[model samples]
Target: MTSAAPTTHIVFPLYPGVTHLDFCGPHQVFARLPGVHLSVASEGGRDIEAEGLVFAGLEDLATITHCNVLCVPGGFGCVEAMERPGFMAAIRRLAGSADYVTSVCTGSLILAAAGLLEGRHAACHWAWRHMLTEFAAIPDEGRVVNDGNIWTGGGVTAGIDFALALVARIAGVGVAQTIQLALEYAPAPPFDSGRPDLAPETVVNGYREKLADVLRDREAAIRRVAAGRANRASQ
Candidate 1:
């Protein structure tokens, strides 16, 4: 008889300003994996007001010393989340025992802030990927990047790609393919404005204009987080 599949503990770090889709899209794929114990953990186990709807609740991180996989989801709240005291330090500690440390979109920023991506390649939302230098992360241009045990996805929807790739690594190609098929993960968008280079110059410019304020604020936040980490390390 075959032995039971090893149970894998997967955790998604939660915050108030998350983008729910970034969390849920990859979650559906990860949850489908066999023998996977998926959980959402926050600094204080509080409910989050994400971009979409409200997240029900999450567990506190105090009891979790490690996990098989830890995925950090990104959204508008990441900047403020970085500012929270001991937040990045806690993530750094939890990541110490994580076999795979991953992120989706701006979630990579959080990982970088935690010092997980120092001198490592990572990807994030195009709008803010440039800010990775603040945390000493190499900005990767791919949809999903797997550098050593660190995996990062670009933008919001790219979480699906990251999840499938990780599933392939953890399980097998057959399992990943089956999950993809079950999810009917096909992309046939009506327009071709997915990336900045592919989109028309006018569209890119418009997006830049719309997000100008957010970009400025996010840049400052990243700098602040980096400085805070530096100061803590010195203490």
Candidate 2:
């Protein structure tokens, strides 16, 4: 008897400047599953960089046929990627077809731009939640948010939790717990600034300073999305 191929497909969309951890953290967990096919997709089939790390052999966006799960990672490049018409269209296609669509940090912004977060409760990097208002999304600002088939995580490292939650949903709680234990997933951050509620004024202000420029760009992207939606409505 021949073995049947697994149907689950995990698609990772790569941009010019993705964060390594944003892709790798959840990727490591998903890759652990047997028979799960993982594909790194880009606007074209080319090499991409993530925080100075180069990833080779990514598929072009046109090559994406279907996916059981889709992951959009965040980084400095996201400012451009989230605004690209083709990129947002590709994400919208995947999110509309995928069994589960999820994102890490500002990756949620990309989904929001694709009009996927409308009326959805989602999570995003605490520093960037204000932008979610533009998408008509209720931002959780939590480590993870599960809104039916869509999942989102806060900041970079939270991708791990996002992936684990998917695992729990797909395989079972035992499988998810096993993977978590194997990864030794226990958290005790030395600093309290990981979340805004716990962050001190100085730390919060510092984070604000770091995000100011990105926030400006994000505002522009949100405006673009709004304009696009308006144009589509007029059509």
Model 2: per-residue Cα lDDT over 43-70, one tens digit each: 8877897776889878998679789999
For each candidate in the order shown, give its overall lDDT on alpha carbons.
0.90, 0.85
Q: For candidate 1, write residues 78-154 as lDDT tens digits.
A: 98877776677677887899999999999999999888999999999999899998988999999999899999999
Against the true structure, what is each candidate's TM-score?
0.95, 0.93
What CA root-mean-square deviation does each model show from the true structure?
1.4, 1.7
Best by lDDT: 1
Please list the residue runs of candidate 2 whose C-alpha ends up more than 4 Å from where it truly belongs after superposition. 2-5
Clashes of 1: 0
Residue 123, candidate 1: how far off, in angstroms? 0.4
